[model samples]
Target: MDILDILLSASFWAAAIRIASPLIFATLGELICERAGVLNLGIEGIMVAGAFSGWIAVWAGLPLWGGVAVAMLTGMAFGLLHATLSVPFGLSQHVVGIGLTLLATSLTFYTYRVVLPEVSSPPKIEAFQPYEIPLLADLPLIGPALFSQTPLTYAAFLLAAICAYTLYRTPVGLAVRAAGENPSAVAAQGLSVTAIRMGAVITGSGFMAVGGAFLTLSAFDSFFFDMVNGRGWICIALVVFGAWRPGKAVLGAILFAAFDALQIRLQQTAIGALVPYQLFLMLPYILSILALVVMSRRAEVPAALMVPFNKGER
Candidate 1:
């Protein structure tokens, strides 16, 4: 089919939504961290660890949801380390985040070797299947594209909505945002800046891990090396593209997913015969970079982002 026909197809949209699911989770996690004025660059490694943790847990006989919980806990453990170094200690966030990424990634790889030294290929598990919402799945293009997704996809959307509401409509959210925008104000109000920032990082990292878990538990049945494939970094950019708002960030994820889905389809079309395959691979990232540039030009960053706060000193 041609590009137009492909774009109009229900299956194409369904694929787009499916592809966007993991990104939505990770982007939201990154958004939460940035909103709290911390940048958790460890997301890439955390995702890798999460993917393995969840899959291994399932392989070891945990229920599907149990695997998810294990992944979140694993991510939170890393988040705790990130927070300990960057928040109260007031170290260089960039350095700490990158270091955490290396540590987590290496540790995960070592554990994988230790657990299955003789295995040539990663083992497979029963991944999540698509769950079609009754009447909603019966509708036109929108139905299958939006309603017929794995449970994790639904959770991603739900989490986005909850994040938006919490950031804009709740008192606790106010404190979190205040901690990012003005830590002194948060401290003045008797809320601990260190506590708020550390909490945000820890919680956000859990969500990031769940994002990784989605890859293993929903998108694919088996885990392998480089499965995450820099999606973590993409989610970071998506957070900036969405201006750190959950709803907008979700839209950004879908947009990128659409680009990705389009490129895959394009590679199978008549035009695919004449072009280099690498171009097809680059299409989504090129489009995303252009979009990011346009969106970020107008995006407002949190005033206190990446700025360490030492209580009683300022």
Candidate 2:
């Protein structure tokens, strides 16, 4: 089919939503971190650790949700390490984040080898099944695309809504935003900027881990090395694309996912025969870069983002 036909196809949209699910989770997690003035670059390794932890937990016979919990807790542990050095100790956020990534990635690989030393291939497990909401799934184009997705996909969207509400509508949300924008003001009001930043990093990291779990427990049945494949980095950019707002970040994720879905479909059409496969592979990133450039031009970053705050210091 042609490009226009492919764009209109319900199946294509469904694929886009599925592809966007993991991104939605990670982007929201990153958004939360940045909103609280911390840049957790450990996201990539955190996602890798999360994917492995969740899969291994399930392989060890925990229920699917239990595996998800394991993954989230694993991520939070790494996040705590990140927070301890960067928040209270006032270390370089960049160095701490990168160090955490390397540490998490290496630990995950070591654990995998130790657990399955003799196994040549990764094992598979039963994964989550799609759940279709009755009436909503019956709709024409929007139904299958939105309503017919795995439980994790639905949870991703729900979490986005919750993030938006918490960030804009609640007192705690105000404190979090204040911590990122003007820590002095937060301190004047008797809130602990260090505590707020640390909590945000830990909570955000948990969400990021759940994103990784989505891959093993929902998108696929088995885990493999490099399965996360830099999606974590993409999530960082998506936060910028969405200007750190949960709602906008979600849209950015969906837009990127659509471009990705389109590229895959185009590779199957007559155009795939005319162009190199590498070009198709690059299509999503190229388009996403252009979109990011346009959208980020007007994005207003939090004033205190990445600025280390020490109590009683201006």
Candidate 3:
């Protein structure tokens, strides 16, 4: 039709990519942790924690990159806590993660009220600007539609590819995989399972933090109570959908995000009056359950996931 129609049509895909951005980052982060035989169910909490930390950092005059760095550090701290509980104290991984999530929820709310007690309106931070490559951004149809996205979107794509390569190609990746599969066997070969686990947890946290930072600093330009909005759980579901493969997880993230974007657009269209918004909101979870049901028979989960390892006991 006209230029307005073209923009509307293209906006659908663009919005999908935008929604996918955070999910991809968070899902890939969860994939890394899970692949290393650790089930950190705290992904959602860590994400919300990072969202607030990053937002506060930005509000305090730190550069946007600084905010991201602080968010990563916050995630790392939580990872350290998680590792301590599950790895050393022999606590239940699921329990520890649930506890962490609760702690994060409390922490985010406390900080929000304490810091902005009198502010009646929500506060915002400056979001990251899109950086478009001139010639490429000008290309026909797909080019501008894809290349004109926020920087975080490109970073998510690159990180997914890199994570795939790291998990399947490199020696370090091999060590991590081996540790997850058979810790005693790996340790007998002189590799430190604990060390590998620590590294994976930390790295995973960094990725998760970036996912949170992207939400406040790029997607929404502000932090609100529970701003992550269960995205962390969505990321965990994505890992199952992707079978813990980085590339597949990213694709799943895109699909989940597409449903989310579609729901938002539908809310604004004439069809909104005919359909229940709750059904649209529930689409991602429904897809996730369907994926789990279909893939359970075929998916290969890490053999030792969530099992605590003790050198002497082995």
Candidate 4:
């Protein structure tokens, strides 16, 4: 198809949203952690763990919801691990995060092989199907793109709103922000910075797990080692790319998903042959670098991000 044809297709937009679904969940989760002054790089492994945990739940004859619940619980466990290491013990966030990622990824793959063994084909599970919204599905272009989505897709959109409200409204939200900006001040005010950070990290992880679960449970069938690909890393970048705002993060995610969708569709066309498809695949990452450079100056990250707080120390 031609350029205009590609841009105008409702199917294309719908595909973009689908591609972005999981990323949004992960992004919001990370956003919460960062806003609370803790950077959880354990995100990649958490997602893999979630993907593995969710798949295992379904394999055991549990429903999709049950699998999701399992994934969230698994994610929370990891989050608590990160919190215990970084928040309570005052460990380096970078080391803890990277270490967790490696640990989680290794644990997942080893378990997968041990449980199922190497086979010609991996096990498959029933996945979620697209559910059309009755009234809006018929609208010319926008309706099909926005309204006609799986329940997960709609929930993702709703999540953006929920995140926006929680961070911008609510007393607990203020405490989280304060903990990020100035923990000593929060501590002086009788708010426990440790408690807020731990809560944010643990709760945020559940959302990240949900994102991973979406991959095996909805985006595609069966669990594959690399199914998560670099989506976790991309979610991390989008947090900065979105300037830590939910609406902006969603926008950044959609933009990345659009390019991702374009590259996939282009790879199938005659134009794809004229240029290397690998180059198109690089668009998202390339934009990530360029966007960070351009957006970094204006980006407002939490003041204490990646810094550990020791209650007894000044």
Candidate 5:
């Protein structure tokens, strides 16, 4: 295809959507938890666990939707674990999160080895099909590229919108913000700070898990070692970059995803064959660090973020 043809191709946008979906999901998830004053460093582990769990569900003859469900449930479980350790026990969230990541890494490897002893090549499955909007898909340049995408991609966008609304527009949202800002004040007002934060943590984890499932079930249709590959950590940085706002986080995710998509495209071109592929692979990390440095000046983190709230205080 010519330059114009390739630029306008459905495939280019498809690649962008594919790259954006997981990041959008994960970043929005982190937004939810972080907005509620909890930092989940275990996100990497939770995502890895979700990827393995979702793949196992598919391998067990469950539908992709079923796998998604399993992944979400697994995420909720991890969220609860993080909450229990950090909130009630008053432990450092970073330490708990890191421990959880180490645990998840071990669990994923153990399960994979046990379930697929002879499988040298990673097992693959049928990925989810993209949904095309009737009239929108037929539009000019950006139509097919943007309108025709997988259900998870659409869901990622929808989740971003919904999270932004709920976090800023709803009563529960107010409570969540209060819990994150001043749990004692919220408690004096007869609201249960613990409950609100716990709910946020669990729900946030579910979102992250869905992102992981998107990677395994929709994007690749297979599980590989460290398949999440620090995308979970990237999500954390995106949350910071977005200043704990879901809409901004989604925008950040898409930006990062676009860079990633560009890297992949470069890898497949003639120029890609001439250069060292690892250099291209490093672009995402370098860009992420640069983005983080730039965005930090603008970020507005919650006042109580990363601080354990004592139930008996005040």
Candidate 6:
């Protein structure tokens, strides 16, 4: 009946985790790209491409896991295209990112239409169901919400830990940071700046694809136009708010998803009768923008971000 009732509901938290799953994937992918200083604005297109390709693969008789793989590969291919243009060829990062976004988005829509009937009813696939951990799922307030989830949800958390460890505890991570902040210095140290950057792009793009696949394969079972619904853009914004850290990004994703879940529930409740529910829907984005403005100056962006690394010159 009130804000406390909404916040304390276990079902509400459960819904939030479910909604945040795909966002966790997308935000991590964006964090990786930005950490590498690539500014891969093609993130939205990549998510769309993965969602469509993964759905098509499922419809074509591949296993659900296989569909996820297909989505990642599709995203990786786009990542390579982006890396080739911006990393090795020294194209403008902004131009390359936008071009790739347009290319990927157009190609995905066109191919889907060409292959399948572009009718009103979109095709559907079997979606992943929740797997409740025995003891953990039975816990008081947090149990059902945090413990019972699809494998993809669990994987998102695992990924957050893996990314944190990789970025902060490994030599490869240092090189990744160096490539983004000072590629010239990295090149001077005899490391191939191109290779490091390309690796980041490919890996980051794969994560983006996984995010998209989560939508089609786990969150929802059907594929349609605009299924991504600007979550990719939200992920980009969250990266800035998260300060480019994987753990912080995960926190940001979960927070945004909480608002998202709340807004959906609020719209369906009697609360909508008393107030404009659409305002609730804007909570996550509005919060993100405010967080960015308030914290952007304090955020530590890569020093050489968006600047092409010309090895022979400066």
Predictions in order: lDDT: 0.93, 0.93, 0.82, 0.89, 0.83, 0.87
lDDT of 1: 0.93
- Global lDDT of model 6: 0.87
Alpha-carbon RMSD of each model:
0.9, 0.8, 2.7, 1.5, 2.3, 1.5
lDDT of 5 at 63: 89
Candidate 5 backbone overlaps, count: 0
Per residue, candidate 1 scores C-alpha lDDT tens digits across 1-314 of: 89989999999999999999999988988888899999999999999999999999998899999999999999999999999999999899999999999999999999999998998689999999999999999999989999999999999999999999998999878988999899998999899999999999999999999999999999998788699999999999999999888988999999999999999999999999899989999998999999999999989899999999998986
Tell me the TM-score of model 2: 0.98
> What lDDT is reached at residue 157 by model 2?
99
Q: Backbone clash tally for model 1?
A: 0
TM-score for predicted model 6 compared with the true structure: 0.96
Overlapping backbone residue pairs in candidate 2 total 0
Model 6 agreement with the true structure over 16-135: per-residue lDDT tens digits: 999889888878887887787788888889999999899899989999889989999999999999889988898998888878878988999899889885567877888888999899
Question: What value does the lDDT take at residue 104 in candidate 3?
Answer: 76
Model 6: residues >4 Å from true position, as ranges?
118-120, 268-271
Residue 150 local lDDT, model 1: 96
**Runs in model 1 with CA error above 4 Å?**
none
**How high is each candidate's TM-score?**
0.98, 0.98, 0.92, 0.96, 0.91, 0.96
State the weakest 10-residue window (summed lDDT) of model 4: 287-296
By TM-score, the better pick of 5 and 6 is 6
Candidate number that wins on TM-score, 1 or 3? 1
Pairs clashing in candidate 4?
A: none
